[model samples]
Target: MSRKKRIAIIGTAGIPARYGGFETLAEQLVRQLGDKYAITVYCPGPKYTKEERKTSFQSARLKYLPLQANGLQSIPYDSLSILHALFSADVLLVLGVAGAWLLPFVKLFTRKKIIVSIDGIEWKRAKWNRLAKCYLWWAEKMAVKYSHADISDNESIQDYTAVRYTSLSHIIEYGADHTVQVTPTAKDKEEYPFLHKPYAFKVCRIEPENNIHLVLEAFATMPGYTLVMIGNWKNSEYGSSLYLQYSGYNNIILMDPVYDQRKLDVIRGNAYLYVHGHSAGGTNPSLVEAMYLGLPVLAFDVSYNRTTTEGKACYFKTAADIAAIIGNTRLAVLRENGFRMKEIAHRRYTWEVVARKYDELVQRVLNNKGKIPVTPSVATIPAEQLISYELAHLQAPTPFYEKR
Candidate 1:
């Protein structure tokens, strides 16, 4: 590119990140590549707070709008950001699939390049009802079709998009550098009683896709094994129900959401076993962070999880499977697996490396080098058959998708 690409990054929650993957990615991008790219980040404005009156934040051009992030408001918030960004910026690197409806209009009106990441198979999340799933599916399709370059954060996501859209996706995942091993302070020992115990650790949003119920169930039954799980238990009925169900168990410990990195890292880094029970999406933030910290992984037996562990860590599909591993898997075996997990993290999942990949993709998108393959002839299948197959595929059917 001739000069620093003026980039307008949309679809993330906000900067000075204390939330999830997209926010962390934004924060890291500004630190690593801000000098090379002029960035404008869209933030959700205070519709309800005393501090909501404050507009901009930090070094980047912060554009705040009156919309709550991460829900139904995500559509309008991202739509507003994309529409506003079309006025300036050389490239629009939209980080999620929320505002894909405006993508065609952006292309028709301007020569600005667009890059989108349909963040993990979002529609498959169990929190969404059937109607929301349909919208997310459409948005995912549009994001792939309209963007100058589409990113798949994991190899499984890359494979899924390639098979469905016949478009090769650029793979760039969230990095796991935030968690680190910490020698416990005297104050830390005073607060957390479980710091001395041989405990299993997990932290995630309380959702069905995350399989919090399963993890809790397995830990509840086990007598000697101590399990500590962290999440927002007040967010939903499901979370509240799970909390009520498992709160009395002797072996299980449930903590509310904690954003303090030093405290959270101490908890995560000191665990004997890291239990990950996520059933949907690509590479998960918590799972990868545990891997980075050299914790032995006992992940759910999903293809995405399997791929992330590189076929080394132990996998479980049921409560019985989790229990069996917990009872039988030795510390020596786990340490060896943990060593391999750490090696994998070092090789491919660092922020500096992820930042470099994003920068390269941004340059490619701006240069018009990320091209889609030629569309193929439509398959000679009946409409009824197509609908039936699509329905089955959405649930559980044969390999409905092929690598295109």
Candidate 2:
């Protein structure tokens, strides 16, 4: 038999999936594709201690870089990883667009295939400064333009890319089957007394773009109900301020990040409702995980969230909206919503499904010559003829004109 093709994964905090969506994606990809490919994952050195670090995970090799995997340091971290990967890897599976500025060089100088997942519309996020946003915006363009294959996590994002880049982006969302339902033990009850009562649960980075403040404001007024929110509160000034303001509420429980999967599942799976406040990003792992656990969802009113839930879950656009929905909705209706979410998750959000999609993309990119565009045959027709034929709607730059 011939040798296995080498795959290098870049743009994650490291494995054992201690962080957010991309880390978990990396771990699952390794488990799913390790047998078929010689995979090497680049991790952040500063995030792991000597004891936690390992040379390999499962069948994939692990390489550590000195720079952090996110924020300002991510630029160099991803740049260096791509440079190192060029030596021997046949393909570069990039998870984000932070280092996409170098992708043009890679495409121009090297023959290695690039399969990049543009992890949401990063430049549109509120956390980045003007310069950072500009850089990210340009980087996103480069990532889509230069890669052999590009992926979007939601249909809304795919539509956005089809309009902006005129490229047919593959839609591959994150898997949530790794999240399990757990029963709270007697000891767990002692540790978390809130487990005995009904509460709305939410876990996300304490970012402004996530609409955390709006969620807190809504819950603060609902003194009769409890909100158990988990996040890294001390990591940022916005989070710290929210913690200070909301921690004093009798009905709100603001807790730190719980890395123990069982403990988190126990708290999350037991909640009566899951409140997803994210106003940005596509197909969030936390939201999907909650759905997989059969929890009812009240997500923010946004196109991305709507696409993820398939317009089946309740939505809130403001603090008043959240308060009114929770205060008025019947328990039976909420339970039914939870069932709908679970059905969707089971059908679309499993590791096996996601892995197979990635495998197909990998095989295609390995043999493909150039990226495909979703531009329609109608686009090639004369504009004057389209107007004369009453087909002017097709002239609009959107995915609606894509071939059926």
Candidate 3:
């Protein structure tokens, strides 16, 4: 048999997927594609201690670098990974735009194919400073332009990139199959008394863009509706202050990040409703995992969230909107919505489906020469010719999207 193609995964916080979406995606990719390809994953050395670190994970080779995989350090972390992967890997699968500044050089200097997944519109987030935002904005541009192929996790993001860069971005969303519907144990219920009651649940990073305060404020007004929210409460000043303000309310339970998957799933999967306050990012893993557990979602009214749930789940723009939605929505209607969400998740969000898409992209990039735009073939035809054929509508430059 011929040798398998070598693949390098970069820009994640290291696998075994303890962190967030990108790391989960990397783990799933390795699990799904390891047999078909010779895979190597670049990991953050600082996260794993010498005793915890292994030379290999699953069937993929693991290479660790002494740098953090996020924040300002991510630039050098990802850059070094890319430079090292260039020597042996057949394709470089980068998960973010952090190291994108080096892509143009890679494109010009090397024959290796680069596939980048811009992890949402990072620069648009409220947490980033002006300088970080500026750099990320420029880096996102570079990643889209220089990479052989680019992936978008949501349709709205795909539309954004198509309009901005005039390139077709492959839509490959996160999988929720790893998140199981856990039946809370006696100990679980003892620790989380909210398990006995019909409560709304939410889990995400404690960031301004997530609209955590808005969700808390909404729940605070409706004392009857209990809301249990889990996040990194001490990670920032904003999070700490919110925790102080909201924790006093008997109806709202503010807790720190729950890294234990089983415990987290016990609380999350049993909730009557999933409140998604995120106003940024595309196809959030937390939201999809909730859907997979057949939980009805009350999400922030944004294009990304709307597209992810296919407009089937209820949405809210403000604290009043959230309170109004929860107050008026009946349990029967919520149950039906939960069914629809589970159906959508089963059909669209699974590791098998996501992995197959990545494999297909790898195959296509290996054979293809350059990026292709989403612009219709008819757009290439002259205006006079289109007028003659009475196909002017087909040649229109704008793509129609549902107003958010």
Candidate 4:
């Protein structure tokens, strides 16, 4: 009889997917791949009590660590998970760069395969302090350089790793099929009075990088539209200040975090438009979820957002930009954009497709003795060959092209 390959999924809040993107992805991976592999997931002890902790969740073993899965504690938390996996797991599917400092020892000492997904450029988020950012920056490099195989959730992130580490990163985005477009029931309407009105909606971490203040300012200035935004307003002083500042506006609704999936979906799916203010991260789960819900997105102007929407959605860089867009854009045009966004999501962001990609990559890495071939950098390509492929408009001899 053949034995199943043991896979350890590390660096998530844990399995029932109560938290964010990593948790959801981890849960979906187990559901999709558990039949073929012997899987175990590590959960944060702080989030789940002793009674809540289970031996297994959805056919995968659950191991709890007595520390937080995020913040400064994550460094040691992930290190412990990696050390434990070293004994029994054949493959360590690490989800972030928090434990990257230990990967060198794991690679040098063991035959275990390390597959990492850096989960966007964590060091660049404005929420992190200078010291935290510096550690994350070093960790990000180590994660890529030491992994057997690496993944980037967006092409923009892939380009970054390609340029910085000169490594080939597999692109695998988050799935949105789990987000259902729901209709509000009478009880739901009673609880959320805004459901009866036409309104714009947003849900994200209330961080400076997400441009939450800018979104709030836009809606506050434009009284013609009602905006409902849900987030962890009490998490930081910045969030609390913004919530207090914007809470007074009759047209603006500052909501607390909503964890129930159906409740969130019902509010999100019924929006007239979805406002995505995130300026960092690759393939944001909220933006894609909004797309899957057939909501027109008005996103912050960033390369990552453009790549996710394929340059099809409305964009804004400032409060005035957002206000102008909302005030001027016609409803029919917005709905048309929503249709295009949904079509793109349905074709690419399903969990089945994402799982298949991960399965193929895992199998290929195992077959090759847990090593992925390094791809050549674009700088090595001949200049004349690059010039030959230029478009007609860009073919004209200029200072930029003269080197060729």
Clashes in each model (backbone N, CA, C under 3 Å)? 0, 0, 0, 0
Cα lDDT tens digits, model 1, 149-185, are: 9988888887788678878788787788867789788
Query: Which parts of model 4 have CA positions greater than 4 angstroms off?
Result: 369-404
Q: List model 3 lDDT by residue over 133-182, tens digit each.
A: 99999999999999999999999998899889988899999999999889
In Å, residue 64's CA in model 3 sits off its true spot by 0.4
Q: Estimate each model's TM-score.
A: 0.90, 0.94, 0.97, 0.92
What lDDT is reached at residue 387 by model 1? 75
On TM-score, who's better, 1 or 2? Answer: 2
Candidate of highest TM-score: 3
Stretches > 4 Å off in candidate 2:
378-398, 401-404
Which whole-number lDDT from 0 to 100 does residue 157 have in model 4? 84
Residue 44's lDDT in candidate 2: 96
Comparing 3 and 4 on TM-score, the stronger one: 3
Which lDDT values do the candidates have, in the order given?
Answer: 0.85, 0.93, 0.93, 0.90
Residue clash pairs of candidate 2? none
Tens-place lDDT digits, model 4, residues 218-288: 99898879999999999999999998899999999999999999999999999999999988899999999
TM-score of 2: 0.94
Model 1 CA deviation exceeding 4 Å by range: 1-3, 47-58, 372-404
TM-score of 4: 0.92
lDDT pick, better of 1 and 3: 3
